[model samples]
Target: MESAIKWTSNETVLGFGKDAIAFLDTKLFSKKSPCDKKMYEILIIEPFYGGSHKVLIDMLYKALEDEYSDSKICMVTMTAKKWHWRARTSALYLSQVIPKQHAFRVMFSSSVLNLGDLIALRNDLADVKKIVYFHENQLVYPVREKKDRDFQYGYNEIVTSMVADTVVFNSEFNRETFLKSIKAFFKVQPDFRPKGLEGEIRQKTRVLYFPVMYDVGSHSKDYESTLHIVWPHRWEHDKAPEDFMKVLRKLSEAHCDFTVSMVGEQFTDVSKAFKEAETSLFPHIRHWGFLPSRREYLDLLSRAHVAVSTAKHEFFGVAMMEAAFNKCLPLCPKRLVYPEIYPNECLYNDSEDLFTRLAAFSRNVSAIKEVVADVKLDFSKYSAVNLLPHYVSLFK
Candidate 1:
């Protein structure tokens, strides 16, 4: 029997519309096949299906197929844009499309959707055992100094936790901070605060690290005398591209002999800092913007010597791990998810420390290589081969 659902190019962009409903109804309900040999079916809901979330979902899907060969996986997703609209609306579309007759044994959802909102619709999901996976939560999400936090999004996560049979966070930091923030949020509520909700949610929450889907290889050949630094993170504010550029500026002032590759997904609204870097740091840049092909991205990682992250917010560092697997030594901030993933030698105390480390690295690339050569990152815990069994047990 065929193992996966082959989706057309256009089918992925189908949103909450008449055309989407019609297409989903036909694709899901009208199909009758001799290949229907699965023992059970699982439905996956990922409203923001792009970047890291998309990568994680794809890995999970592949793992599920490998672990449970006789199971079917159905997905309902949307592009990663207009997130507020996606969160409030995607559930309604899913409720309308997933047939009542289809006995889905389990429904796995990402934090992007509010499962409580879906349950309120009183759809086919009523009897289905639901699991909510938190890629990141809005409660602990950092915002710009002048901007106000969206309480609605955080509240939705809390409600979804209440609705789900089990809640899983990608990191212990994410789980603890979110649970702590819930208490803080309730304290400020005017009236009718739900008591012991945090405790209830905490009891069911488990920390499962995100899987890294890449093969570890021998370190890349030394690029003679060049120091190739790569920033493999989204071009956004939370990633703190401005800070990365500042480091480059300092390097340029000191006349450091090195090259940089600013490689990651660039959304419609890219940081102005990157635009400025294009002119000021153009001489030092090797590759810029997103590489459409995964082969090309991996190739870039293979050639790079160091991977750096100056993120203000990171629940889990997926890109960093990917680069490390490709033999790039990581130099990241000592806070957020970095400290947990990397050893003390791989981290810097602050941005100034990071700049100092980079400057020293530029002068002597061999020293950096020597340090990295001695350390071995235990990536097995996040590998699909090791983590798939746990997922299978959870799904069962």
Candidate 2:
């Protein structure tokens, strides 16, 4: 059957009020009334639903269900693959997939989707309290070369923020960097750039840390044993695996008594650094590759002495925090989000600085182990117990 919905612009769609409802009744629902449709209190749309995106949604779903047992929530999601394609077309695809239900009070989504286009396509969602969460922004995301940065992806994010009733970021750094880069990001445009958009979007912006539940059991730290280091991050170029491998090679050259667990998620084309590390640092590797079980992964972190991150692009470091929660000391770069999340003692300015810190710790394993046992990293703010309420409140 031919549909009857039509709109001139996003403004026209969102400007819809009582008249739009009457129009829907007359046009699209000529045969059936709005009351005949299934009702839902909440609607969630996630196009790139994988990795941290999946983890966050799963946590939020469980939290919402636990809090409001009677609330009917509907979610539409796609697997996290071909991210660029998902970003470009997910909104249109999801618009058709989502069924027409009774008016939704709240709509939650990540920044991956083109929210403006989604709202334009689905008139029912126009007046809903739309919330877009930014796990990462493309504006400052490091590319091999500045020229390689795709303008459309970043522009889509800016437009998404404009349409959302509430715009949220996983960290303050994530929020600030995106807002700061808006002007610079638009400089590439030849003409007809927007004005006052940054300020307009800022009013609805919020910084909420990604909620993590660290249910770790206490483990005895052995001071006499060799120091175990874990590098738990994606084996991707953005994570800077090459830099990490170089540091491990340095430790081996110095004859440092340490073992490494190079474990994290890996794609089909694994980083070449891992293959190189296998031959050079074979004696030092205790565990390598992705551990399918969460229990096994957490167990490895619990036993390890240190967790290190050498990331060129990180909005928030979940792996580092997880390791820290499991009693492992986190060693991260001073720049990016490390300063915002970890203490100065845990951050290193350069590879030499990281090597120096690791060399000292490796030489005196007993001393470092004692420090880890005594001093606990306070991650209370990011805990699911504390932040879940904030997330739940957003729906209302």
Q: Write the per-residue lDDT of candidate 2 for residues 1-396, one digit (tens) a residue.
A: 122121111111111222322222221111232221457677776787667887777567656666654236666678777788889988888788676755578889999999989989998779989999999999998887778999999999999999999999999999999999999899989899888888999999999999876655246556578989999987877889889989988999999989999888874476566788787888998998888666667778878888999998888888888888777888889988879887776888999999998999898877766666665467788886688889999987
Q: List the residue pairs that clash in candidate 1.
A: none
lDDT for position 306 in model 1: 90
Question: What ranges in model 2 sit over 4 Å off?
Answer: 1-37, 217-219, 373-376
Candidate 1 Cα deviation (angstroms), residue 343: 0.6
- What residue pairs clash in candidate 2, if any at all? none
Every candidate's lDDT: 0.75, 0.78
lDDT of 2 at 92: 84
**Model 1, range 310-343, lDDT digits (tens) per residue?**
9888888888988887778898898987777788
* Candidate 1 overall lDDT versus native: 0.75
